[model samples]
Target: MNAEPRPQESLSGKEISPTDPARFPRLGFLLGLVVVYWALYFVVGAIDKPYFYGFIYGLASALLFAICFFTWWWGNRAIRRSEKILGFVLIVGVGVLVGKFSDRTVNFFPLCTLGLPLVATLVLGWLALVKRSLISSHWLGFAAAVALGFGVFDLIRMDGFDSSLKTHLSWRWTPTAEQRFLAENAASAAAVKPSVAKTVPLHADASTWTAFRGPNRDGVAHGTNVPTDWNSNPPQQLWKRAVGPAWSSVIVIGDRVYTQEQRGPVESVVCYDAATGQQVWAHDDETRFDEAVSGAGPRATPTFAEGRIYAFGGTGILNCLDAETGKVVWSRDTKNDSQGKPPMWGLASSPLVTDKNVIVYGGGEANKSLLAYHQDTGNLAWTAPAGQQSYSSPEIVTIAGVRQCLMFHDFGLTSVDPATGRKLWESGAVMKGAPRTGQPHLVDGNKLAVAVLDGPGVSLVSVTKEGDQWKVAPVWASKDLKPEFPDFVVHDGSAYGFDSSIFCCLNLATGKRSWKDGRFGRGQVILLADQGLLLVVSESGEAILQAADAQARKELGRFQALNGKTWNSPVVANGRLYLRNAEEMACYDLTPRRQASIR
Candidate 1:
């Protein structure tokens, strides 16, 4: 009865009839707008020349927008039977494009292109099932598109695709097989050599620092009565010459002084005139290697033996050179065939020549442990089961009436039958350091003292024979005496070596610090007992001559010889001292006759 029988209101707000084309058109237009906007967004993103991640992001945006549009369009077309299939095809086509784009950028981790599309598909599929409307079919279409996109991306990211892409992009960076072979051969060639006759020694009595620790490997000079006190100036510089970079010490057989140096790509075994420090001859071969901790060149001291010079490079290249000429006799690349990867500080262990066999720590398996190669032919003779490879050179010592080769390995100290590579006995002396670099010196032919740098202090092991078996026991252990470069020398019942910075002396019998003072500044030391002095070379190339006493540290002389660091152990022979830095070599005669002496 009131206002014109007011308009009748229905519960269902506006009846959306399936037969109404206008309502469906409006929905289709809305869906199309969303699709167009998404496509535009993707196109704009792709224009920025994006990398993998950016490309994936762009594809995702485009796919999302297309999904929304298709879903709305599906709602519009589902009402008309003829337009439904067409709407589904369009949605599927849009999905396929999204999937293809997603595949192009899957290399980006976590934010995977395929992952998002697959997730969107699953989510849309759920939403579609929840709503049984035409919009639901649209979501299903979107899901299908995402799945297709994911599959495309997966296929494109496969190994085969990568291979093809690499082939297409191959350039000079891709090394040819021939180039690789040549490089490999060059590395292997370090082990081969030409033969040269050894020059007769100028004088047999003119001693040289033959091996690492000189004649006895005990850091003791035999029969050379060097005066303890000089008049005013100790000695003179006979001569001085510049050598290449190396940490190797000098080995003077007679008139010639041999050592290893790095020129450029080759590590050369250089021989100099002992009297004048003149460059005599150098055997250069290309065996270049880059190291971070240790300097480039040779680390092992050249062993002058049987008319041949044996040298080990920083890269584990062992070369036998002619004593006179710079000709190579035979070489062996321990890096290629042996399990011996060069130590972190480089191969510092000099080759030990015993009888006719040249012994070295090859770091091979148990069968090829401490290798004994024929000195003449470079042929493998025998190998002992050395537990671990050591940077310390093997010392031939007669322990307890039996001649044995004493060597240090990663596990501990070991003695091997020098004749047959047989293990005589091994003391379970665990070094706190992972790698043992310094050679253990024998004290009075009865006790052995070894120093480790990184961890664990020095230990003196006494070797004794118990019936048929040899026994070694820790006499004393001291954490105070840590040597980073070389082992301490034990003379007159005392151990003298560098401990981090301070030069220390300890009693061999008791690991007690007798005296620890006079910081040598983080360097390695070589004890010259005959001269009654300790030759300490600091990391800063300062050569110090001090008294071999633990009670009172007395500095006799000091001089800075080189510009670079001096990690090389100095060699003193025939009253002349040889020192080397990374780029220069110097010789100082500590005799009363020379002009420039230790002043």
Candidate 2:
């Protein structure tokens, strides 16, 4: 037993006694940490605040590198100090190089940060611990395993994300939805004679959606009483058609619908036939604005006023065009008019047309914050100070018997005269420097409810006028009912909106949550006030029907309406439901006469 031992030979028939010591001391510990890390990841994604999501993700990433180095250290039982240092440089160096230089989307950033590295560790363990004699050097085997891991990741690309922050990934070389649509449109056009786009006749319908949310810019669908009994009377799809990338919602005016989208190098204000889903007229500009998460498109929903279309582009270009001809009557670059740079998302003011002026958010330096232009002439009417930027549009609301134009931005709630850009009142302390998105909801008669971005949730405040000064003060704030990009509506003394991506109801008077259920993603909703029902559009393009009750969440029925991510709000007029996302537009009959048919 005391005799000098000879060199050990591995299964590869090479001397490996010095390097391969037949030990994986770090293996058991590595497996245990993985379980703990995943448990924390899911919990953080579910209940944690929006800002703290990165902290846990970053801490776990550091542990992955620790696993790599420790596996190399403990796998070698008899290596010298120089060999140990050299192994460190090799394993850690290549990892830093690959992780930093790889092309990827933020869609899968949090998930793949730990997932791919763990896969590599599994491969290393299989060869080093399970099949211990196969490798001559632990360092070489570890390098091979890491390379295979990156190779697998390199072939995968992220498309986008759902509301729950999960990635939608696909093979790298796969054709995108936009590419397929473009190809199909080109092929169809080539089959016929290339002719100029014709002007379509326009008329105001009996029941119309002439603005972003409605005539009042509130998410209330009037006149149509949608039957909630889907088994007995289900919604039927009338038509569906492919559309370009855009966050813009459709504004229905009688037989034609108006919206904006980005097609390749052009940003188009298009009019489509509501009955047939066919292109009636399209006006294109030589400009395109695109972002990774929101994709490429115009951001603001076009408004129809005085038989003219008022459309604001994502890149700050605002155009007023003839309703029937799609001809630009007047155009102005709002970025230049306001003297302010575009925000990270871009200019998203849905032009507010008044009796004398058309108001839009300027967000510029100095005192040029809000800009109003003459309706007929493109002359600048007035400019006033506002928040630096906002994705919310200008809304006209009457508070305390006075008509005021309301704008929600980083500076919280602001009110100005629609004809002249004069700041009337503002509540800025609660919402400073946070990206304001949720539309300011007028609660009761004098109170207002809004989404506070970093303030974490919903805030209700009372607005009253004492003499010449206007007073706005907070009533109650609830972290349980936060809604950012999606707006909320007040119904039967309660507010109905998304708490994060899940549907929730909160008491307007107390700011206390009543009930929250159904994970509908970060989609949109419309209150069918005529029938006391809520029509919800899920992010995955499903139409859900539920009663507007504060006691409990009662889901009446649901059906798939579109495909892919749907963040755009739904429009209901008469007995028809009109909805769309960046990729497509659709119409459905929600009346009892249509006994559930989908195209």
Candidate 3:
């Protein structure tokens, strides 16, 4: 006996059968999931703490996959039977083939959501609905996907990731920021300038900024009064020029500014004129440190002390250069000297130049994490324990009437004697597997504030010194202000910095948030202590001035400082403001002239 005719419907001028056998049977369901998948991506940026952006985006992408896999199993109650087993085999085989042959950087989440779901619905769904062919559609799809795996992705490349963990992709043939800068500068290059480092005096009062995060490494500019009224007394651009790719902040002394950059394969310590923004000298090391996560170049800033420029390269080389001319005084292989493995993002510890020794954190190993070499002789002075990893630089501060060197590592905060490399005190780590960044902020001389990513945020560790021993413990741990990589500064009994991507103020006394306002990405804040003002340089290179009050936030003025993703810290010295990122550097005249200039 003949079976009753199957129900037929017309879609797009083609006759369709509802129960027709098909390679991708649940096209309607997949269409719905794709809609939901796209919606999830649109909202992931709205999540708090950009470092936690993966939590939402991963969950949303996994939800559709989990449901797809579950339904695939549940609907096929007899999938093991001989008659129904072919579809199962085909599904598993196609997945394995595509995964194994696709480009290494091609993520599965995007593949499943964007490529497979949508295309399968169009091709297999149409064939199943029209010709009622399951095996043919399956074979055709397998062939098409295999072709895509070997052909389409070879032309693409991953540039890097933003703070939100979103992948930045580009064409493989496109020129990078460093390459474009090199080509442009070489075309119109002028004659090489002589060394001006000798003409400028390196010695200055406490006002000169010769270290990362300013003179004290506290991210505070003391005594200078920055003009807050940008409308009335706007900043004038002294000079704007392109620089090599680097995350290093600039250090200013006299009329000279020094920083690090990656030029081609060489990591250079470049000295530029603070007045003309001219290149005076550059000490190049024949090495390169390039990674996809944070792009490339040096992460630590150059330190200036006692007529010497101390710079730590990204690949773990330390060099002491003469401040008079760019001559190498002494060089040490820090990675080889300490015998420790480098971190994922490279050794970013900005060298701390003390009276006798230059101290830096170590790689993973017992009693080898903190290495202090002689300042002039380049001899290994001493080594201390500092856990496995840290991007934080060693800081010199006086706590409880005792001067000690402070360093932040994966585990926690460690205070050591600068002269002896003795471990004075240690605190426990907050976020496991998350290496600490940003130097420790010492509040009230002893209270230390340290922050971590994807963890319980910043913790206030109380450091005190007793008769013969030292003690360190957390006074209050909180998520009130998670600065990620940017350093926070304490002023007027209150701490101010970025809470992930937003600007926030925290009361250092109570750990309570005074007020949280503004989205500044991952930028640094320089507290102009004399003017009671805060100069904020955002990740996208906008400089904003706001009232440094704990009660309420008020924006005084803002101006475009640079034109790229800015992660490096800014420097202000001798009536000038200097800012740089991976792309370019600029000198602005904040010299109380009250004139606006843009070039």
Worst lDDT 10-window in candidate 1? 159-168
Task: Show the lowest summed lDDT stretch of 10 residues, model 3.
Answer: 7-16
**Compared with the true structure, what per-residue lDDT tens digits does model 2 show for residues 486-524?**
888889999999887788999987889999998887779
Better of 1 and 3 by lDDT: 3
**Candidate 3 lDDT, tens digit per residue, 1-599?**
98976654222223345454322233455456556655665676556555655644565566565467447544743223332354345444655565566545454644554444444434344434444542333445544543453334445565666676666677767887888988876664565556544456787566589888987788888868666779888788988999999899999877788999999989999988777777778899999888766788999999998889999988889999997688999999887767876677888988998869998876666658899999989999998887778888998889888898988777767788899988788776545446578777778777887776225577787777789878876688778887777888888988889888889999888888999998888788998888888889998899998988999888998899899788899888877789999999998888657554455
The total of clashing pairs for model 3 equals 2
lDDT of 1 by residue, 518-599 (tens): 6555567777666667777776787777888767888877777565556677777777777776656777777765455322
lDDT scores of the candidates, listed in order: 0.63, 0.76, 0.75
- Cα RMSD, each candidate: 17.8, 4.3, 4.5
Candidate 2 TM-score, C-alpha based = 0.86
- Candidate 3 Cα misplacement greater than 4 A, ranges: 1-3, 6-24, 50-152, 188-199, 430-432, 453-455, 592-599
- Residue pairs that clash (backbone atoms under 3 angstroms), model 2: none
Superposition error at 367 for model 3 (Å): 3.4
Count of residue pairs whose backbone atoms collide, per candidate? 8, 0, 2
